[model samples]
Target: MSYPKDFLLNLYKTMVRIRNFEIMAEKLFLEGELPGFIHLYIGEEAIATGVIADLRKDDFITSTHRGHGHMIAKGANINRMMAELYGRTTGYCKGKGGSMHIADFSIGVLGANGVVGGGLPIAVGAGLGIKMKKTDQVVVAFFGDGASNTGAFHESLNFASIYKLPVIFVVENNKFASTATTKETTSIENISDRAVGYGIPGITIDGNDVITIYETAKEMIKRAREDGGPSLIEAKTYRIKGHFVGDPELYRDKKEVEEFWLNEPIRKFEKKLVEEKMLNETEKRKIWEDAQKEIEEAVTFAKESPVPNNEDALTDLFVNDSGYDY
Candidate 1:
């Protein structure tokens, strides 16, 4: 399928932004500038950028631990995301949630889940809420391959199926779950195949191809918007880094990483854009430069923003509360 020039550019920019942000976050974390366990979404940028490209401001999404890319793709503020990483009060979670639980409800992000498969059930609940309210909004639940093994994933899909809720289950199968490779843990060749048990369409595609991801997800997203039932997508990709920053990663070979790096989504997309004349060397360089600048500014904002007050922690705790408190 073909794409508009601006659409392609925007997709490219999103991927660049995610990659740049991850790189900067890694640098900061290594330099002891940020706190918490950092799960970098470096190699798998296309899945989030492509899937969330056409989502509405009202379309809800549940995120996994490796969720920064998903939030960024869904229009999260770079400054706030950086601040959250920095644990500054100006963050989306007022510096309380740190890297794993940053949320921007204004943009329909439900925040990153620290628990495996946690977002799936949340997405189902949101989908049920949408159905009850009789709205056209849909929910996209992002999870890793490891989450696919959880009871939450199975139960959430069952509920969504029984009710025909507008939810999309996206499995970012990056091969490795934490430090263990899927080859050592998973039994199936395609994780999407499990959707058959729930009576929904399941498809596995190359996660590195941004165009393929965007086109496929755009259709599924549209189908959900039109009240179609949930579908499962298994995006096959390789995790470029160890599970988190500072991970010793004794399980994999460095040569394997080098080979996968050659096939990373950003470089592949950049090549396609250049070949199609939709992007040039100058444009490509500028995209990364602008994103890096934004990252730098976000770092400054996070460093300067005040820390959250100890007593005011109870506020902003509800999804829709009338100041309910203990």
Candidate 2:
């Protein structure tokens, strides 16, 4: 349980960054400043922050719709991410792909998928390539409780297991698939239990505890990089926000959300840090202040960036087909 002081501080900063970004994003989306539907990673910040902390820069991650946290943890450019939300030309996809599809291959963020469970196969493919190239890079595929029920999830796990691919299947069970609760949808008690069928090691942990998440991910990622094959981790967390910004949220009781708010990951982690004397009121305030400044700069950059040119719509749409003056 002993962690370097700097590492623990970095984790806290990362989680703060994610929380700030999601809160600002939600505000923007509600104010009609953002163009597309954004799934906020508000309560689930710890899972991404902890899981991606153990990954190398060259390691790959396939993200779900609620993926800003993953990219932030992986060190994606914040300004470009904001630009993408604003549909500006400086975005990762040049304004073509918004919240759901922002991808930066250079950083090993394959893409943020709109389709549930879409990232699983992509993770498998990346793992297969890493295997073919004889590299030690591992792939971490992120999905939700709903996606865990999809056929792609099952098939990808089976294929990755058989090939002994370096892939980590992380299921962020926020307890709801859109409007449906996990109890109403999923069959098993724990999503990780399904790994038994795929013959991969699986475990469930308290997703809100950043330390626990980081340690679990460290072991699993180390296993994959060492050619021990795929594994599954089900992180039990909650979705503090509605599925998307502006969702009516009629499905859940306000009292329940209020209760979950008291147990949100950031607050829990902050309390731990404070008790450990790693953080204090002033330090915590500074972290939040810094995140706010960074997010504000990104918003300014996004607002000032140009929109994609209409005439160049077809450009970069393909690779080397006898280009017709696109």
Q: Tens-digit lDDT track for model 2 on 144-210?
A: 9999999999999999999999999999999999999999999998999999999999999998989
Q: Report the lDDT of model 1 for residue 93.
A: 84
Instruction: Evaluate model 1: give its lDDT.
Output: 0.91
Question: Count of backbone clashes for each model?
Answer: 0, 0
Worst 10 residues of 1 by lDDT: 317-326
Report the C-alpha displacement of residue 64, candidate 2, in angstroms.
Answer: 0.8
For model 2, the stretches where C-alpha displacement exceeds 4 angstroms are: 322-326
The reply for model 1, stretches above 4 Å from the true place, is 314-326
Q: What is the lDDT of every predicted structure here? A: 0.91, 0.94
